[model samples]
Target: MMHTSVGWHVEMEFREDDQHTRAVAMVRLPDGSEVRAHGHASRHQTDVNQPRVGEEIAAARALNELAMQLLTKAHGEIDQASGRTSHPIHV
Candidate 1:
């Protein structure tokens, strides 16, 4: 059995206000490239105050965007090396 492990570290930052939350997520690839994505959440005027919920929503959106970006990057790299366009499966 192979005992080797690989890891990646992602960083996220948030800027929040009473009615809004914005998040940015970033990760550095082993090839020395950095990818970043942003997300935002806004509370409705009638919504109750919930900072934690806002943070969670914003963070999840940011992470989702980051994942999409990474997939796009990898897909481009594959196309470049393979010399053919490959269709992507929708998630």
Candidate 2:
């Protein structure tokens, strides 16, 4: 019998520009693999200039992209282990 434990860490950073907000999200895996995703939100001419709102939107988008990346990685691993190509997994 074999047993293993794994852990990962997630970090996010938001940057504000003159008319846009950018967010970067990173995931660090136990095997030293790092996955990164980015998102951006632009202020519209008629929309309110809310820093918090931009940050929230950008962060959410970045996290969503990160989730998809992680899922894809897992699916690829599963395919390799199974030794057969399977349909792409959707989140």
Model 2, residue 63: what's the lDDT?
91
Model 1 deviation from native, Cα RMSD in Å = 1.5
Clashes of each: 0, 0
Which pairs clash inside model 2? none
lDDT by residue (tens digit), candidate 2, 1-91: 8998876777889999768999999998877799999989999979888999999999999999999888888888988999987676575
Best TM-score among the predictions, by candidate number: 1
Evaluated at residue 74, the lDDT of candidate 2 is: 83
Off by over 4 Å in 1: 1-3
Whole-model lDDT values for every prediction: 0.92, 0.89
